[model samples]
Target: MRTSRVDTTIFGATSLLTLALGGVAPEQITVPAPVASEDAEAVAGLWLSADKTVRLRLDADWSYLGRVAGRHRAAKGTYRPEGTGLVLRDDTGLRTPVTIADDVLEMAGHHLFRA
Candidate 1:
């Protein structure tokens, strides 16, 4: 007599159910920690939103200036790489997180692209 074995797999919220059902053990997963950008020059430049309503200028001195509607000042601050992104410290002491991916910068729910 021959016997066959069935294999089952589950993901997300169902992983526990798989274990309870005596299915194959789920593999241990590991995620890497985010690291700050090493080369500041690489990200230094002018970036603008798709609709042209927002703009950000990243300078070589690590200082930044933001504008809305092309001329109205929205924010003036300094920026530095922090954990896979940048932390913009405004002159008023407000801090905002900006994520840099490719040629795009995401901050405060807005996406800015290199100009």
Candidate 2:
């Protein structure tokens, strides 16, 4: 009688690499983490909803946009500070009101947080 054994070594190597990338590679990367200078806290980074169903991001270029559950485009617009609130203006020229309190962002009766 003859018996054969199939190789499983490749999967093992892939699994090890995946874990190492998660646990070790991120630290070894040369990219610098963002620092919150007083000016930086003014704008930037990922934002999301209280229900975790929506997400948004702001860049220094004055560009702002939002997604639904990190998948579909829900809102995209330009944003700027107006007093303590933010004004989100869509391409259609429609404007929405956004307020930031502590770490929570309130807009259209939905609450969001910095993520």
Candidate 3:
């Protein structure tokens, strides 16, 4: 069965509780490692939203900068590979998940394409 992130969190908590209560713990609780995407490098470049209102620039150093309407800052963050996507941690402590498929990138309901 495929487990969601919430499910994994619950399972981990349950395992910890069981151990704390002097119950036998399961054989092991494994956390999946982050997968390195071959597309990581390809993802580093300028991107724009469908309406051309939002612009996102991803750098090879894992840093990103986003703008709206070509001049207004929208987001600035650092990203890392997570599963088949990426986790972008912004300067304001907000984390956004980004999914890549073919030549498109999706994040927070916005679809972006290479510029």
Instruction: Give candidate 2's error at residue 63 in angstroms.
Output: 0.8
- Cα deviation in Å at residue 59, candidate 2? 1.4
Return whichever of 2 and 3 wins on TM-score.
Answer: 3
Cα lDDT tens digits, model 1, 1-115, are 9999877754565677567757754444333245445566878899999998888998978899988885655899898888778899999999999886766789989999999
Q: Quick one: RMSD of model 3? A: 12.4
**What is the overall TM-score of model 3 with all chains considered together?**
0.62
**Candidate 1, residue 99: CA error in Å?**
0.8
Give me the runs in candidate 1 sitting further than 4 Å from their true place. 1-38, 70-72
Which of the two candidates, 1 or 3, achieves a greater lDDT against the reference? 1
**After TM-score superposition, what is the CA distance of residue 101 in candidate 3 from its true location, in Å?**
0.7
For 52-100, candidate 3 gives per-residue lDDT tens digits of 8878888988899888775655789898888867888889989989887
Cα distance off (Å), candidate 2, residue 39 = 4.6
TM-score (C-alpha) between model 1 and the true structure:
0.66
lDDT of 1: 0.81
* Clash number for candidate 3: 0
Candidate 1, which ten residues in sequence have the lowest lDDT sum?
26-35
Model with the higher TM-score, candidate 1 or 2: 1
Per-prediction TM-score, please? 0.66, 0.57, 0.62
